[model samples]
Target: MKNTKTPDLPLSIRAIIVAFRVFFHLGWTKISKKLGTDPTTVQKFFQCMQRLANGSEDFWYLLSHIEPSGCHHPAPLIAPGSEESLEVRKAVLKHKTWMRNNAVNYERSKANLPPLKCTTVQNICLDFKHAAANPKYPKRIKRKRQPCKTALDEEDRSNWLQYTQDLEEAEAESDILTNELANKLKDQIQKLKDTVSQQQKNAESPGTLEWELLQQKNMEICAYNDAHFTPA
Candidate 1:
């Protein structure tokens, strides 16, 4: 069964939220004010996200369905692996601006320094979710089963004979006393089974004391496992 626990939003989305979560960690009405987008757009973003969480979406497919204007972009038109994602580029640009203002200023701003930006890692959690749901990827190949041997090896056959002989001896030794006890247990068990079946037929609910006693008898039968008739 699939786990139903709600997972945390990805770090990229969490970072985006952090940018706008100040003051009250408020509703989209307030957060959208920080995001410079309308509250309705925020509502739709989460609506789509809830659908995605419920295993109802693919990666880019889910994003494509979102209100594109909310992110200032339409469906993905950028070539995969050819151009940086718009979100990553924005984060990188923000980092470079921060570095130029804070870090570089400690020396001399723009002192012939190379262009700076944070190296944004490609986020693949959505792809993982989509593949886990729809499974477009290949699974591991299974090995073919080998044919069974026609006959046991000599040592194995000899061991098997000894084991069987010992088992027979054990059974013979136990049988005499076990037979009489077994017959008594068998009648007692049959009575229990019939009574239990009748109790189940009579019960209004399954959890009454009579039902529990019936279940206990079934458990006892399983534990006892009669000789020959119901092999242990």
Candidate 2:
């Protein structure tokens, strides 16, 4: 018997279904304002479309009218020893060479800094190694020596001492800021882990059936929206 159900679908209903498929593939945000419908409603409609399309021949026929052509062809597979592979290797080598040249240029630019005394350079390197070995090791600040202020007037002596004190205070403040930032980041990570654990427990709980269903629906909506909607 001829399917009476086929003729029962109104033309307007079919048009809306096709329009929704296009909009969902293109993006829901694009048509929400034009359709005067809430984005959430459009999103739910999209999920319904997906479920219907998956199970119903009528829905599949409606969807096929809007389904894009030429999208089903498998991407061309590249064989080993192909020109494409050789070109990719060449591109990688070119990038490596460019990076090496930039590093050399950077080091050359820094070469003009005042040369460190052999003893000072050795001490700095040693301190750096110690800090790497022991996280709690204090960093040494480099201090530039000024000419003896005692040989100058009393005003010069007072100015030198003030400058040194200011330098010490600035370093202390910087260390405090670094410690505070590390602690803040650690706390944030712990909070994120706690939130994830709570969500996993909720998912596994018997009482969270509704919540899980809502999440599944939401994922379907997102998939439908991604497939149909066009970005502005």
Candidate 3:
């Protein structure tokens, strides 16, 4: 059988995929014009990209960023120490544990439960974010996500594993480099208090992109200093 597992994507490719999805919502014609491609081609390419993003880490990250605009059936604000709240907490924990061990198919589970009561607890527990926040429930420990793998020969599988490992290491190293650079800049600024004055001079210069960026940074710094260092 051919290996059918979806391949991992680098951060840059993931960002592009997210942008494509966002832009796609505007219209196919707009995307086609921007890409200088035919509408049909853009649509087909988008379908492919959507499938690729479906089960990827970036896709989950994108999902995490989504915020519900409104809740029609908002959960009632039960006092934490009250009898109703105690029962609600128990029901939430019970359903949470049940869902963890079983397929999270609500309708299928509903079939096994007594009529009318079937969806009662399920509906409340379906609000995973709220249900999972039971202060009485022990916090679930998080683990690093494992890469999805496809069936392959020993050699090919080994190579794929190595590639994923290297990809994760590269991402970690990139984050470390960013932190190191920021720290270096902070130390330099502290050691040379005149650095801000020098940057201000460069920022004042016109026409160049570097000067434009410096001016923007100076403005941001001024706003931060005003907010933090100024007296009330």
Candidate 4:
């Protein structure tokens, strides 16, 4: 069997559906029979139409077949990419704006709506109402994180490894130089200590020799004085 499902359509097509429902007063089953769609789909479309008609004067104007300024502009016939098509597109957009504004004012006049209050509280209330009537927003999906990867090429990796090896070799050389310097300092310190100890021993031996020589010289001097002259 051929698929009878109702594909999503433009607002104008939906407007025609609402017109059919309103003019004929058809139930879901009868409308579904005529449209060759499921009764459930027809019912949903009707509900959507009703909500749009109730909320929008522009939709009401579409249903009522009110033309804006007694004229309609068809879509541009030129190729969309052509320079001339830009002007045609602008005209079409301007006509649409006129249609919306004129239709809204006409519907408001017919409905006898009061002047809208511009107070802060009224604006807040309107914002809240619009928010409540809004369809549920689609939830943002979190993107899966990509796995971490190294950006290093083979040349870079080899260079880094070579640098580390060179550093180790330099450190080893520095340690050898430091040990040689320490040994040299130790030998110089030992030689200085030995020289100081020898100098101290030589100074002490001179004092002992001077004492013995002075005593011998004193005995010689006393014997000379007694031999040279008698007491007068």
Which ranges in model 1 have alpha carbons more than 4 Å from their true place? 1-147, 179-232
lDDT of 3 by residue, 1-232 (tens): 5322213323443344447656445465665455444555445444555454564435555544332331123544544345443454454444443432132234335546322242443443344443455457533322223455557999998999999999999999999999999999999988687876666677677965669897788999999999999987
- Candidate 4 Cα deviation (angstroms), residue 183: 0.6
> Which residue runs does candidate 4 get wrong by more than 4 Å?
1-149, 207-232
TM-score of each: 0.18, 0.28, 0.20, 0.27
Q: Which RMSD values do the candidates have, in order? A: 25.6, 35.9, 27.5, 32.0
Q: Write the per-residue lDDT of candidate 1 for residues 1-232, one digit (tens) a residue.
A: 5332213334454335434433245687876555555666555566555464464434444444343233323333323233223332333234443432233233323444332222212222123332233233312212232444578899999999999999999999799769989999999999999997877775545788776877788878877776436744
Candidate with better TM-score, 1 vs 2: 2
Candidates sorted by TM-score, descending order? 2, 4, 3, 1
lDDT score of model 2? 0.51
- Model 2 misplaced regions, further than 4 Å: 1-150, 213-215, 218-232
lDDT of 1 at 76: 39
| Candidate 1 displacement at residue 124 in angstroms | 30
Q: What residue runs in model 3 are displaced by over 4 Å at the alpha carbon?
A: 1-150, 194-232
| Residue range 126-218, candidate 2, lDDT tens digits | 344432443333343233223433386799889999999999999999999999999999999999999888877777675696568768988
Tens-digit lDDT track for model 4 on 1-232? 9666764544554555666776777777877676667777666665654554564435465465432222223433333234332322232233343332333334445557322222321222233432233234112212233445678899999999999999999999999999999999999999999987876666456465555566567779988888886577
* Predicted structure 3, TM vs. truth: 0.20
In candidate 4, position 214 carries an lDDT of 61
Candidate 1 Cα deviation (angstroms), residue 145: 6.3
